[model samples]
Target: MSEKLRVGFIGAGLMGHGMAKNLVERGFPLTVMGNRNRQPIDHLVSLGATEAKTARAVAEASDIVFLCLPNSAVVDKVVLGPDGIAEGAHDGLIVADSTTADPTETKRIGAALAEKGVAMLDTPLTMTPKEAEAGTLNVLVGGLAEVLERARPAIACFGRNIFHVGPLGAAHSLKLINNFMSMSMVALFSEAVVTARKAGVSVDGLHELISAGALNNPLFQKVMDWPLKGDASGLQFAIENALKDVSYYNRVAADAGATAPIGATVQQIYALANAQGEGKTHVPKLMDVLGRLNGL
Candidate 1:
């Protein structure tokens, strides 16, 4: 690694674009892989970041590679598939995954990378693309302490609050738990608002009470207010993605011989929404799905 770490970023989607931009702007030598969407990749290229044709190419050219991909499945394919990161990784290369992923799968990937002398860290992010653009995202990291320090500078390019939660898979586990809490709240709030609306209570009134109470939170506000204004893109997280996180959380609980009845119910709620053709809808649009379910 050079004095300024050579960084490669994969998945230049909504969140990845902003994160990569911050790293490049902060003076890291960045190489980014092209994505299906060229806009972000082109933007980064114009900002002095190099473009690579494949994940392997990116990994070959950088000391540390960052992944802001969509899910664990994609992460798996990108890191282990033929011509993937594992193929090009060198000793001392660090792969920092900022995706909310399955902890078990993350561990497997980490162990595989370890065999190649490539360190893998689960550094899942919180907040949204807006926060990513503002360089104020929260990063929950899981890996060895020394490895966390090695990646901290690049992580800090986009994360205002960085927590080293545990080792190997702990950050991803904590992310699932965090998403379970957040998405469950959205599910409960969705059902409550619909029930209240059917009983002639204004959603605004419900919002006021919750906003003034101990339950007030940024998720509650965005989930409630976004749809009220007929804009579901405020959260920028898909219902399907929320369902995936909750499902992973339930699996994590079950594997640990614990119960997750609430998580199960929340997963079902998002499953129902996804089944009703709202999978691609923003998570905040759960309100709309619940509304349609009750014939509102």
Candidate 2:
């Protein structure tokens, strides 16, 4: 509630915008940058939040800056590029990066911030865009206990569940593993459904039976639910993002001297989808691709 705790958001995409709105509604001094998607930016402005002209401007205007970028490349550019936060950041500024990113890069940024007395918390988030809009995101945080404590209230504004997973980069590592599991499940189910349809089983019946059985999962209800209703585009999450996450997951596993055979195979399927130019399509688009492959 003091003037020293202003919060700024660097990305205003699907999840970023919702989190920013929650901060503003919670009475936090909020500043946000505009993105390619202007609707969310405009909405946040309507909520009594100021619009920042650039990533650095957001950092310069606030005490804590949150980066919700898509990947490490964008995160690097925003924090280290010309007019980046590292240049404009005040001493002791707390940066909470919510991107699902590489742990090594996270540590690199955290170490850089340390010299200036700034703190970095790699707090990646999970949940669909719908959950983000509902302020029910699950945040996995990795940082010093005291730093995470300082970030808790702001994090709680947008996340219904928040876990202090471990030290720096731990949250990102766990996020990669979690996404790999999710993507792998979608791929596995896609293959099974395609085979079932070919064998004269009803897709809707299979879904219903599975939902009533042990093989069911929340994602089946989420991605496949409306697809069952004949609305192909209701999921809204693209395969391109899934592929990106799996690729990141691969790197994390390789770094840890581990091999993820299932994850690796799912990445290949996603790679095939990308090659077929379905990268922009949602995860459920796999059904469309599978149907084509089956000559359905």
Candidate 3:
């Protein structure tokens, strides 16, 4: 709180905008790179955050750069490609990523950044974008203790429950696992809903019974939001993203010599939804997707 760090942010998408907004409101000097979307970029600039032409420019003006991009490929390109953050890397600079990404890729990127004296932390996040906008996303930090301590102040501006998991890549590994479980729950609830309807049981009855039983979960309520209340705002994740994370979990498990039968099945389910052209549809709408599948 005493000394505000200069912060640079890339990927001003769903989760990034809120995280970047909090950084500026919390008083860190902010520099931001423009992404495909201009609304969040303009909004951040309107709040007194400086806009940079490229990731390199953002990095040049920052002591710490945070990336909240969608995937590993884009994150890698922004940090390591032409006119990217690597071009502007300096000694003692730090980069933290909140993208749900591959652990192997995260480690490789961190190692590459280390050679340039830029410490990297994989700080994958939990909670929704609503929570992100509220500055309360739970931060699963994966990096050196000393580096995290140095970067804690700025991270504290947006995180609620921040905890160190391990060295670089650990947080990402955990994130993939966490996402897989949550997305699988979405699929499970969707099937249960359709099955309830097909068997002459109302979704309302199913929801009421589950609400009082061990099958109840926050996600169960969210998925039920669609059938019971026609509200998809409860879980805003895209079906495409669900497939991505589930597939990533399977790959991570294979790399570790572990089998993931559940992850494999979940991957195919989301793939089916995506093939049905519901890729961009949010998770709560999975109820509809499965409902149609069951002819209900």
Candidate 4:
């Protein structure tokens, strides 16, 4: 029988914790790196997963290293900086980055890793931390088909809906495009809500009209309902992260020489929210940010 792969996980925060837990529970020999918060690292350690001192250590101790960080900048720093994955990576080692990153950076990192005989795959994730916990997150992969097949089992531990989008940086590019549309919708929705409220329209009435129409979607429901219930925690994604993704999207559009007026507009709105100290708030709370901006 073939042996299970040795898996190392970096970034044991909201989304990473559940993903790491499933890898360990699925019989993989898992090693998790320490993060700012000890609770997740301690919890993973208690589940028979070993803890590593640094990203390099985690990479050295495992066959497949999974990164679930915030943005491209952090991903770049962790994989290419001092004491990073590149330092400890060996020939034939696979690095799967699950962060929504810049496609250009992903390509550059993939090239660097390739020179060292380390294969880098862009495997950006969809869904939320809730789905991450349930082991049903959606994974969009971009790399060699054979490499994806090899990593499929471990990825399946946390992802139920997985798609091999294309080669190298395609998945990250698609992720940016996807996030642009989603965030744009949320921004437009928030603006509509704030405008309606100013005109003395009921928020619940607006929700009812939209919910009963073809415009309703799972994302719309999630962004609206959670906030209405006074629990924006259901989304599990921060406003700053949303801004980061939209900014990445704008960059992608600019590089492609395509005009992205709406994307640019959404980016500005998120920037405003972040400037108002709502960076750490959940994405759904953009409603509150917009409301406050309008003096509501």
Candidate 5:
């Protein structure tokens, strides 16, 4: 097993497919496990990656492994369960997880893997699937200095601006803070647009005016463009993950003895949107929910 830093990807979703392709194209011997969604897995395999039958096979075949999962629960099962990576990974193997998760769970995973002679690095990513496909995702990392240095090259394939934020759980902490603000903005923007429409302003005009001046951002552009173009792919991001981040963000804020009323309110809004069966649509689809409520 003296291979040249072979890599394995445990998830091949919207983000993982591109990241794995980038690694394979760059000549890293890559292995990827097939997920329930076969398209991305097939795409990665076409790029010359070996397909592993299970997470353990991926662990047995690589010196470095990356997990781009949905949340801490999936991450826990893949890394700590019976046939998990930790169960098969050899000494000095590095497992880097790019999932947004609870800080305590991250710390617990780190400690458990450390006992197995494998180090766990939490390097949560930020941005949309488009950014991920473009290899411009931002990475906020937390880990030992040595492990971070060793993982930097593979991480570079997918992340444009990578930062070693701090140690252990710092990256997840910062990621929670960042998404709190992001989800809060979604709630605020949806309310503003729907309320403006009720007051006789067109949604397009509102987006144009605000986006041209002070209230514009990448988030604003993406959300406004999606529904405005009449494209509801249900892929922009879901209310479920949004609410998950909100819950983690609120918990983080509370533990620090700080209060964020706006974020709290937005969490409830997303919860309401999920209750209305819009949980699987883009977060911007909340505009429709708000629209009906405002009688627009």
Candidate 6:
């Protein structure tokens, strides 16, 4: 453990904070940057992580840098921007990008990093910050076998399940598809809940009936937590993030010459929610938004 590779983290938001803490707890000499969220960065600093001033500083201090940003745009800005990771990166530095970003952008970035002898691994994550804090997240990785091996030890500190999906950008593709499916469920179930109320079916009854049948799933339980228990804490993901993922998914589908009519409709549902100013709300509260729309 004394010879462990040094690690750097660029985002300290909900999920990033938890993962950064796990790295420190697992004995990685860690560096972190204060993003829009400061609490997690401060907390991590208290627990022995060096607080860097910029992404470049973070890269300069570590063997591998993890980017858990909002999307490809932000990720690109932080990684390739002035004083970004690319500026401070040395040859052989590995970047494990955990942001749910565009696969095309990932391939492009990976190519850019290649010239500097920097390796980019698309290591998008699943599950929640709850699992992140517990060091039990499922990490989908896309990179060469050797690179994944290099990242595995540190990733295992916070990731319970690590799947080396394919080459660069594959993990991001899978993540976007996964989010498309899950976010669509959140939207579908939210509508069903609203319809149940309008049609005189109690929310509890609907939940119980579904729980008794095959329709039950972890996603359902999380989404229904709001309508059934007045808690959206079960799913901490924001609606804005959901919209971004699904939009990314749409790009993935279109690139493959596929028609995602259902995905298109689902995207509109989230787009309306975002336009209605529910972007900052958690996914579960979509029930409330749809309810108000239907006069429920």
TM, every model: 0.97, 0.95, 0.98, 0.96, 0.94, 0.97
Q: Which 10 consecutive positions of candidate 3 have the poorest summed lDDT?
A: 287-296
Tens digits of lDDT, candidate 3, 65-178 = 999988899889999999999999998899999999999999999999999999999999999999889999899999999999989998988899899999999999999999
Can you give the lDDT of residue 231 in candidate 2?
60
Model 2 scores a C-alpha lDDT of 0.85
**Candidate 1 colliding pairs:** none
Candidate 3, position 274, lDDT: 96
RMSD of each: 1.3, 1.7, 1.1, 1.3, 2.1, 1.2
lDDT of 2 at 85: 85
Error of 5 at 80 (Å): 0.7
For candidate 1, lDDT tens digit of each residue in 1-296? 34988999998898888999999999999999997799999999999999998889999999899998888999999999988999998988999999889999999999999999999999999888998998999999999999988888888999999998999999999999999998888888888888998999888888889899998987888887664677666678899999999999998999899988999889999999999999998888787898898999
Q: Which stretches of candidate 3 lie over 4 Å from their true place?
A: none
C-alpha lDDT values of all predictions: 0.91, 0.85, 0.91, 0.90, 0.86, 0.92
Candidate 4's TM-score: 0.96
What ranking of all candidate models by TM-score puts the best one first? 3, 6, 1, 4, 2, 5
Task: Give the least accurate 10-residue stretch of model 5, judged by summed lDDT.
Answer: 226-235
Give each model's clash number: 0, 0, 0, 0, 0, 0
Candidate 1 stretches with Cα past 4 Å from truth are: none
Q: Write the per-residue lDDT of candidate 2 for residues 1-296, one digit (tens) a residue.
A: 34437899988787788888889998999999887788998999999999988878888888889999989888989988888888877876889999989888999988987877889999899986777778899999999999887778899988999999999999999998898988888787788788888898888888889999998877777657644776645466678888988998898888889978877888989988988999988897687777778887
Off by over 4 Å in 4: none
Model 5 agreement with the true structure over 233-286: per-residue lDDT tens digits: 523778888999998888888877897887788889999988889888788788
What is the TM-score (0 to 1) of candidate 5? 0.94
